[model samples]
Target: MKRDVADFWNLLWEATLGLCALFALLNLFAPPQDLPWVPLDLNRPIGSATGTKVAAFDIARTAAPDQVEATTEACMAALRGADVQVERAEDTDDGGFCQVRGAVRITGGDVTPLSPSVVMTCPLAVRYVLWDRQVLRPAATEVMGSDVARVDNLGTYSCRRVYGSVDASARPSEHARANALDVAGLTLEDGRKVTLLGDWDGAGPAGGDGAVLLKRLRDGACRVFSTVLTPDYNDAHKDHFHLDAASYRLCATGPSRTRRAAADSESG
Candidate 1:
């Protein structure tokens, strides 16, 4: 009886030791399981200009001070004369993109007319031309008829390559870096919706407003962005407008009267 009791205790000890070893090994080699989720709430309003929050995983852990300052300045400029309140700034790498997240409030716009609402995420150092400058400001003054609201986006921050290239599959895209944006359509405060793919060629109910607005926006984009691709350029951009800050020569391949004239003269 004494021998059996001793043997049983020894076996229990050995099993406990083995279980501890197994747990350690699993911890050392297993991938992390507590991945964080990115915040997508863009509707919250910020009350202060400077504050701090736990940095999101999508932001870089380390960012150059100049880069951060440039991004902040660009965002402020985009807001124009609106009262902007920046809540917090942090660097993180959440969605495989180098990004910065801070809450912002944009005031003084005609549509919605809210005060100090939160802006979720914007590209760093990439200045965004307001929807007015991109679409409405360029539209025929007569066509707008004094309706102020305009613009729609097809989401941003994609992880794929430029048009999904496999060979020479370079680093991730500008959207991944928060350096690119895609504009899809526009809407007026009077409830008119103008889409890029659907209404760009007078296919919507806006009576050619969509086509006119898209052309104007693309033309302005060529002036603002180093790389601008649109539906008229090729099949790769059949659905949306691609705008990026790459340092390449400005190429306006969209349906521009200036481009057509230049082509005609070169051919003539």
Candidate 2:
């Protein structure tokens, strides 16, 4: 009986060691992006954890303000490593609702230029470039049969409350801190301009290539931006795609729920 017990224990130990070895082998061979615990690298292809990693930096701004600087530097380093051209913006605090930190103006870097140049927080910039390279450009080529030359924007940073509420007690918007981007239209290589207002659902959902391209961009944006408010959200957003990396966890694809959580984080 003692020999039998000893044999069973030895078998169990061997099985445990084998499992550990298998996992180690898998981790060694897997792509960096495929691993959730792997640190985010802009140079790498977008993986399943890319969105969560990007969102974490914005959340860190509120949850642990002290860590913001370090995260921002790390994020910028990742961008530089990827050969993205960016210039640091001067930090500013309005002594009131608006404050900009770890922000940068994205210039030419294998990315489509933004019309009427705008600055964005580093995290959002990362998402922007990724969306441009991985999602936007490819989608445009596939659907529009043209390369994207420039992206028309409403703006990036504006010190204001949510929905531009005039009341002092109102929750501040992500734009109050250069953390949001309002994309209105896109200019194609073939000189075709597509605007959300005119083309989003312009052809009965999927009739025209223009409408299809808009829908594709919107869907791809949802994958990266923590909060993406589109025309389907409300009349106010009827003209542009509101993409932001705010702490609020919302996609606003069809107005499923109003975001109250952002009010708390936007207080910073």
Candidate 3:
């Protein structure tokens, strides 16, 4: 009888130990998230999100409905002031104002024929020209020793969530609203291609100026666009620079120069 009781207790102890180990492994691999660690009453208001508002496009000031309309007018006026020449595309009868409002066909800028003459929102078209004038040309001249022929872009508008991410709760991407542009890289008048894939670290021979150009251009964009996502942001942005006039200035902090240096050191 005594031996049987001892065996039963030993089995129970081993089972409990196994359960504890399993729980630890699960915690290490997939800790629970999206749960209220602090319990709250369901009936009470949980209020707004909590975090530091660091993005440049974000504003602490809230706008009334009337103010929103007025602000839209002001932004259009600013686009005109920038001399962003655009032709109005025929408005589609789509029941929503989102597709028609501020939509324009960008013909060209100081350069000429924005390649495909993409149809996008006036705000984005205007900002693209601004970036070309203020950031792209100078960055090229300073770093690449040539005038930029044209700013090569992937496109401006898409009607989907970010990268078509499967996250159901993810907010609509700025691309969905025609409020963003993806810059593939710059084109020099001499026909040399400066791509993020090949030249972001610096172009030319090792320690050459082309390599540094990518970093300077990225830093310049931080002051020009609300959100300037670079390769530093993630692998998703490794091929091109994503720029937007969204409500936040999210310029990834590190440059490709530092990235390459770290990689070289690790391998060495």
Which candidate number maximizes lDDT? Answer: 2
lDDT by residue (35-81, candidate 1, tens digit) is 12222112222211111211221233365666555555555543443
lDDT per residue for candidate 3 within 1-268, as digits (tens), equals 9999999999999999999897777556642321222221111221111011112112123445455345445544544544545565543223332242445676543433455456665556545655566666777887777887766778876666787876767776777666777877767887887777666555433235666777777876776567888877777787788988777668886655567678989999
Relative to the true structure, candidate 2 reaches a TM of 0.81
lDDT of each: 0.51, 0.81, 0.60
TM-score for each of the candidates: 0.54, 0.81, 0.61
lDDT of 2 by residue, 1-268 (tens): 9999999999999999999998898689988777777777766777787877776556343534557667777777777777887877776679987988887887777677899788888989989988888788999999988999999999988989998899999989989888999999898988988888887777443348888888788888887788888887887888899999877668766532234345545885
| lDDT, residue 159, model 3 | 66
For candidate 2, give the lDDT. 0.81
Best by TM-score: 2
Q: Please report how far candidate 2 places residue 94 from its true position, in Å.
A: 1.3
Mark the regions of model 1 whose C-alpha exceeds 4 Å error after superposition.
1-91, 94-126, 138-141, 146-150, 166-168, 255-268
